[model samples]
Target chain A: MGVRGIEIKKKTTMENQLHIPTVAELMAKGESPEILFWVGCAGSFDERAQRITRDICKILAHVGLRYAILGTEENCTGDPAKRAGNEFLFQMQAMMNIEILNGYEIKKIVTACPHCFNTLKNEYPSLGGNYEVIHHTQLIQSLIDEGKLRPDDGHIFKGKKITYHDPCYLGRANDVYDAPREILESLDVQLTELKRCRSNGLCCGAGGAQMFKEPEKGNKDVNIERIEDVIESNAEIVAAACPFCMTMLRDGVKVKEKEQEIQVLDIAEITARANGL
Target chain B: MVSQFIFLGILTIALVLFGRNAKKIYNNIKLGKPTNRTDRKSERLKQMLLVAFGQKKMFKRPFPAILHALVYVGFCIINIEMLEIVIDGLFGTHRAFAFLGSFYSFLIYSFEWLALGVLLSCAVFLIRRNLGHIYRFQGRELTKWPKTDANLILIAEILLMSAFLTMNAADYKLQQIGAEHYIQAGAFPVSQYLTALLTDTQASLIFVERFCWWFHIIGVLAFLNYLPLSKHLHIMLAFPNTYFSNLEPKGKFKNIDSVTAEVKAMLDPSLPPPSGEVARFGVKDVQDLTWKNLLDAYTCTECGRCTAACPANITGKLLSPRKIMMDTRDRLEEVGNNRDKAGNIQDDGKSLIDNYITREEIWACTSCNACVEQCPVNIDPLQIIMGLRQYAVMEESQAPASINAMFSNMENNGAPWKYAQADRANWANPE
Candidate 1:
């Protein structure tokens, strides 16, 4: 049978699904799957994201948690589908995933992508998929609290002012504003903020499947508006918690040709740096 | 003598037409669910009542909104005056309203001047429509019309308002010269100036008043009768549209389940939903739509403001949101008129999107909140379009090709991006 019509219809089949991304899916997954780190979409597909996931995986192993990567075997959690108004497809995809996660007996999921984090923690339960979802920044903060992640003073590149960009999914979508900043503060107190933050942070031009389709008709993309805010601060390094934000910000830096002038790093990578593997 | 009867006939016709339309509106509203914003009982009632009469959003955009308010209120009070004039003509004694003496007289004078302002502005509007760019969107040519609808309505207003002015001037003249002393004498400033001009012939002020009153009354009736058939039909439709507008401020859209009785029958014959082979997903086209939707298209005033705010339209996309509404109206009228002739609407085997609204217009919306928000009259072009999209995607299996792959992948892989569903919560895992 052709599965095209099944997309939005699957939503009706699976009633009681809130159709929102859940935050509960960010915790650790698997009993003995060697590595169980949530390779959220940004980390699962992109080489750079995989590298960051691998780096965080490597860093966390030293901190005493066994982790495995979810790579090509990864299934989308339907965030983009819902955002794109492909609700039928979103529900179906979410169901297939709930089965997969249930088979894995996943208890928790940690994601670098807040879209994945928000979907997993906040939305997955509506589809009967339940898992504690946490962001890598939260993990890093937890690791620090547990004394497993200790950053040396030298991990700090002194005299360099840095600002953190809050991804909409992380900040506005899940209210994970403080965790990323706290991780950054453990590294640098220069914690300057862009004018718009938290609930009102500008979208990185990648949310709601805008990454797949064309951008809306506007003089500039939403991400460019966000990066302009970043560049205006003139901070040496612009740190973010979401891979989508990193890509958009970096794209902006390239479009404006401010690449050599600015550095965009995930908060986990920056925090991992202080741990000095 | 005949002028008085003519005025009576005109008033009777206007009342009948307006009464029929008003009954239809009231019945539709009765059939309609309470679609207003989510609030407690009193709050919703207040909002609806206020929105209908308060002109809350009109004030958001200054000059046009204020000018519209003048027309709206002027149109309202003038209805009373029109009927009253007809009454006076058929039966004689013209009674002074609460405004005959002091405060109301000032209001009458000022409102008359303001109505003049609306008339002049409407003239500018007519010129603008004639000279404005020919924006072509969704196959409906929203134009600086060869016969502009807004301008025609404005012209009707000008006719009605001019009649009012002439009648008012004539009333002041007659009453000043003929009425028993103080009241008419005081209110008739314009007539006092005309006293010198009328010295020669006793021009019989009562006859003058009746004639002027007939002009005012019949002129208004002519405008009213022209309203439904004209573009200005939106004036009547806009209030109820606002009243029934979706008040859902929630960011989350309703993601309904797709398993209807038909699909259930197709699957496990036992536990099917009661309806057989029902549309489980969403709307397919015009007839599959809710009646409120039908009303929405019919009510559009073709103001290109929706076009202006539409991200798709602004970005050079083929979607003119206003045209979507217009197309719906045209299609509804076409289908409705033909529904009886064809015996069965589907017998003709014509799809609304193909024969009515185009596929290009369907694909253009980014679902941005602009059109819904910017509509001064509370038209939700996005939802109506989404309803059509529902039909195209779910019922017809006619979604855009780009989203086709995405939808396919989601069905097989459980995610738009085709990631492992099991890995969804993989991020919550620690190293």
Candidate 2:
């Protein structure tokens, strides 16, 4: 029985059994988490953003903080609709999700996509559903600052040259530049800067709902412009906080056929790895 | 007395042509849908002053900006000379503002310098368009009518400025000779050199001066009428267009009012559900766009700055923001022409989409806002692209397969993925 128990313990992978508790499950048990993890459309589905979402979850769990995801209850924040000019469709989606959140009495919301973050933090108030919205990078920065989440020896990213690519919505629209930079600094990696960083950051050709369709005809690709900026920075890893920027920059890397040399990782993914998650 | 009548005759014809063309443009702009740009009054005024008057956005590309400012400021201030021209044309007076004395001399000197500036700038622009063959001006869109329109305007300005200078030069010689009816009025420092060329007899010199004077004044009148048909319409429309520019945050797309109302009612819980079906989804014709959008079409300088900045255009995509604006103006002009002939626009069996602007062009747009940012006149090409895209996706269900997949995913899974809602949390629990 002792040998069997040892084998069972070894098979219990933390990655497979993240031990995620749904908001409903917690509520049924008469316990409420402090913050609701609004895993956005990309974070919930896209393979790349999903990794970032998991890293966020791992960090939250490791910090021993009480947090819960909406599970099946969360919906897309209707960013693409508003951008694609489908205001009707956007409202329909926003209303359904807002109704669910208001019903749950959820207040503080944290999301990974700037698209979702912008819509929730800036757009949701006008629709009469208000919540204290925080981006994942902002949350990560605060956790690091408060000594709640400490970085390890930075085995993977230590001394690695990393540069950040700002998402148009986040950097230009919301002005949340420092939080991502601060979060990246925690990994003890050498941080590089793109010439057109911060307010002047180029779009990854993914904002304004462009991610759903192919890029328009033009002399140069916008993602190529952004990736060129990253390449010029001479950073080994491209640090992206927004999933849309990750998608665009990753595609741009493949276009340049430099995927073997340069890696694109989200801030959360790098931070989570550095913390030995 | 007969000379005054001739001047009045030319003025009457010019003003009539100008008035008729202006009325037609006003009516065509009225054909577009209404949009409220009345908010933020102070900001609107500031935009006008900075963008239209200050030429703030033009300086992004310094060389062209300086040349453009020269021609622009020259054209405007030189028109002050027109006040004198009008008084002279009416009352048979020479240098009517000559009573202002040194100020008049100062003004004419300034006018002569500006004429030289306008002359030099127009020549360079013409060479750039024709011989130098600038890349932005060499696209397929500039092959015929647009190319000619650009060249014609430049050439016209060159001729007009030349006529003004020749007339001033001849008058200067006539003044030096003290010829009959040749008063010692207005200064002409630059044209003074040309007085040396006037070695012909005083009678012939007077005839040369009179001929140039007729050509210059008549040419100005013709240019006024020509403006309604040319991209030069921007001279008049840029001010109003910039004044009513969209003042919202650049990234924010306006919400559809009907949808907003419906959503508001749904969220209220106490309100009843919507009664009627949505009338339409998005723009399908020129009439659907705001009057400001139509105004934008009329005001486009055809400079291709937006297309040059467009990523889609850079990557060899069919989406050109300049082309979009041109197509809008072309279609608007077509409608206006039809109305002028038939008293109302008939169903012409054509629409802005597919006929003029293609689905490929509209769909190709990345919505990057680069085009909007680059427009010197504050024309938002992205708005038209989005409006057409809205029609494609919502009304016609003709979006690309990738986009259709996304729409379906959003409809069914509440996300832009094919995964079921129950499995949305699987990313966290990776098993």
Candidate 3:
């Protein structure tokens, strides 16, 4: 169980528990999935982020969407390398990934991480890797819009005050502001906005390779400042879309000693919980 | 005849000096590496029109936007009156464009209104900068010269607008008295209030009118010459800056073609080795930056909007995007001066990185694009920061140990962690 007492449902108990297929498995079956679910490095490894990954999988299963994961073949999108100024390593990684993606004939991708989403959608095109890429929030919003998924009216999150933190790569970097909020609205939660939301949204201090190391000297940590906004919004729950933001904000809530009061959950997690998946 | 000669001489000298300064700036920008911003011609023009001509981005901060728009529009429209001033100065003609009759009156009437707008707007700006305690105006980068430069331009605008109105008032009095060569061809709506300040006598009125005319013309010329020296260069540079804006998703940093070729050769053994003098990986100095980056440096308004919005600066980090642009421009100016003195760029032992901008500032950026988003002229400071980082990592291999650790992790394990690639799918059926 996570800090918020949101039980991490085991694989055996998940409803309609269809086995997720990797791209290689689908390819071996002489078929192609409709979209590729790019579970980024954090989603695969980070404890907190892995829970969101499971919820996303549950949503895809509930909706019966034909999605395939890159699995062992997926590489880091080299976002941190490119941003940290290691263009050589970034290009090398980009070339290898582009080769594999092209080989797989992948058309569209949905990622839970904005860093991977941003790189694959925006930066990869110039490196001979182009595909229709979308964040998981966009995919979730569309699923709700298409009437394929619905939040249970009497779900636990009903009327709960939740604020969405805009991931820099998702919001300002790509301008996908409304999709997450629209998803929240459908979940029947009170969507309170931070003072700095949308294009003016503050970073969770985990961007631009900053997550890999200690931040440069400053008066206070950037995440602490962002947590102040979350506190100021007075929302009981903070909804985030990016794995990096999840880690940073979760750490911030603990630092502020508000873990007992405020629960930091990804939009995917909230949606999954609201739908009783 | 003597006054006409003197006027021509002053105009010639001012134009010549301004021309030289413009050439120097052009050459300094030319020193930068070139990137293609010329592809999207129509889109560029449209952007220039909307962002620069239309003042669209300025309106993001409504209060200052309204005030800035007043000064901008007022000053621009008033410059139309400069045609008459220039013609009047040349060939020693009085009211040279006065032959248009009532239309001239309408033009003068509108100019008077705009002049008054400019005068008041500049006064308000001065107070806001000095007394309003606006956070955007105060920063470590704004100490001394930048501060004085801003106040000087505001004060100059106020003086120029006052001179314009005073000149009009004295001219109106001359017209009322029906003095020689005073044709009474223009309207005196706003300046009509100032007419009482001048004596009714023709001798005194003529002296006052002539004094103001000379002051207005001389002041305009001096200001023109001063544009190259102050942050006021944005008044002219913003147009081109907005035009050459990166017209792509803000997150899409340009891929280094040199690195691409090297990577291609490495991946494909069949390909021949890349043959060329290796270029520097990223921007270490002004010359290593793209010409568009250099132009962005020149186009900075020093408004501090970028810094005000920066997450790093907000968190009290050393990074300030405005300071990055300012430092770039300052180093460029130093380089330009060196080239002028030596007839070529002499090694100054100082570079943009580690000298003007420190590693602390560069490392503090999260590349959030808040700075880039807040820039009214579409200046991209994050590009320069990345460029500096590129130099540090590729050309110098000086990236922080943690970043290097992440890099090696990605290189070996295919992720930025120590976990094995074979275990990547373990999340699917976690224990």
Candidate 4:
């Protein structure tokens, strides 16, 4: 039936796990889950994101933090598809992810993608899945707090007037605007702000799957507008918290032919560098 | 005496009865969920000073909007004159607040002129709606509610306008005979002209003025009681609602679980837990909705502004953001009726997509947040749509088959498009 005829009522494909006694289960599970990592679309699909997440996993192992992957490997949280008019695909993807983390006795989940963090942590409970979802910026911030990662502050990218592009997902969608800024501060990169930063950050032409489909009529692709704002501000470097925003803004920089004048970096990559990785 | 009593009786019945029902339903829906911080009183007071009094949204459209602000100011200041008409009828003393007689009289003329101009501007609005050929694709939302009963509103508008002119002519005659003229010779000269019409008969002018004043005041009261049921409801709902508009950007989807979990914890202390059987998530239906949704539903003026902005509607998609609001209003009426009668709303539940709005329409929403931004009154259709989607997906398990499949694939393969679980970190390779 190609998923069309499969009734959720009959076979119970997507379970409304909302009514389950989870706090009691958590009491049995221990103080915290073994792992809490955000699995983003890029973490699942993009080669660079996969590498970054795998690197993160290796770092966690090296640091000896108790954690488990929500999936043994990784999965897309269906945010991309849902944002597009393809609700069917988004729901299909979301319902398919039966994250048997409960069976594995896992609680906390840390994620690399802001998109996944938003979708899993924000949008998922409607489909009856709830978990304590944390992003890498937050996890890294906690790690820094625990005195695990210390910056040498001699990075080559230092002393540049760098402006940060708050990704719509991370900044506006999740309100995680400050952690990335704190990480950027740790690197000693000169921080600049755009007029439309944080909650008012413009969408990169990627969200709602506009990255896949064409950007419809607007003054410009929201990302291009943002990148131009950065260029107009004359900042030398632009860093972002989300990979999707990084890729989209980087593409925008390329399209504008200002790549020589500007650089785009992710929070994790910057954090990894600051720690002298 | 009886007519005055009857006129007021109608207003009293409408406000005390119908308005009470609206208020009751409003309060009940408000009681559906606790409102956290939607209406910040200080924020509203600040917006009243900065935006509403400053005429900010009007400033966006410029000239016509300036004229609109004049009418708005006129509406505010001259409401006292309406009270005078009622008081004079019920107790016979007029000019209740005539301390600066010339200035107050000038205000009367100015407010009257502004009312005339407001109607002219409303005519422009009617023309834009009818002939502008805008809002084409928002399909039914743009076309349906706005289309129906617009002519009646227009006709009543014209009638009220003509009444204003006629009433002014009669009152000018009265003021000419009874008191000082209310206008400059260069500006109006109507009172000067009224001398020729009134041919030294004070008694006749008094009767004419009394008749016009009565009709004018009665017409206004009729308009007021009618306001709650008409497109003009925006007149009242717009100002208050705009002042209470959501301060956050329309595109920002705040985490719903954190808030709902707090609510659930407060509501039921010994509740078992969140698992797979229920949603600690977005609203699944109107019944599942919070108070703001109901307010947003009631607040819709069916102006089709959101429909006009909807890209999907522009692309000939069946969805109209404005129509969803109109339908919400329509549904609220039905639901309220059913609830009042204590009838169980049948769960042979007609699929919302099929019966209320189209599935294609529901799917067509891009969530671009334009509708929310452009809705001068600050209605958020995106969250409402998400809530409805939540209900269908969570409780009903009724969704587009493709989404179900995507969920399956996500469960098994860890991607919307099924991909190898091992391949998840495949992208993290060195470029």
- TM-scores for every predicted model: 0.67, 0.85, 0.97, 0.63
Best-matching candidate per TM-score: 3
Interface RMSD of each: 6.3, 2.7, 0.8, 8.4
Candidate 2: Cα lDDT at B191: 94
Per-model lDDT: 0.62, 0.84, 0.91, 0.60
Cα lDDT tens digits, model 4, A28-108, are 666454675555666657655554565465456546775544443345766865553334445545444534544444456
* Tens-place lDDT digits, model 2, residues B151-269: 99999999988888989999888888888877888899899988877766988898888898888888899999999989989999999999999886566666677767777786687
Best-performing candidate as measured by lDDT: 3
Model 2 bad stretches (over 4 Å)? A1-37, A54-69, A82-88, A104-110, A121-127, A130-166, A170-202, A208-210, A213-222, A232-241, A265-277, B180-186, B260-278, B429-431
Question: Model 3, A150-170: lDDT tens per residue?
Answer: 887787787889999999999
> How would the candidate models be sorted by DockQ, starting from the highest?
3, 2, 1, 4
The list of candidate 4 runs beyond 4 A from truth reads: A1-39, A47-277, B1-68, B99-103, B136-138, B143-145, B148-151, B154-158, B177-208, B239-285, B341-353, B413-417, B426-431
Order by TM-score, highest first: 3, 2, 1, 4
Please give the lDDT score at residue A273 for candidate 2.
70
Q: What are the TM values for chain B, all candidates?
A: 0.80, 0.95, 0.98, 0.79
DockQ of each: 0.12, 0.40, 0.83, 0.11
Query: Mind giving the per-residue lDDT tens digits that candidate 4 earns over B286-307?
Result: 5556666666777776656576
Evaluated on chain B only, candidate 2 has a TM-score of 0.95
Residue A258 accuracy (lDDT) in model 1 = 86
lDDT of 1 by residue, B339-427 (tens): 54655444456645777677667666655445655566667777666666666676677765667777776666544566655654443
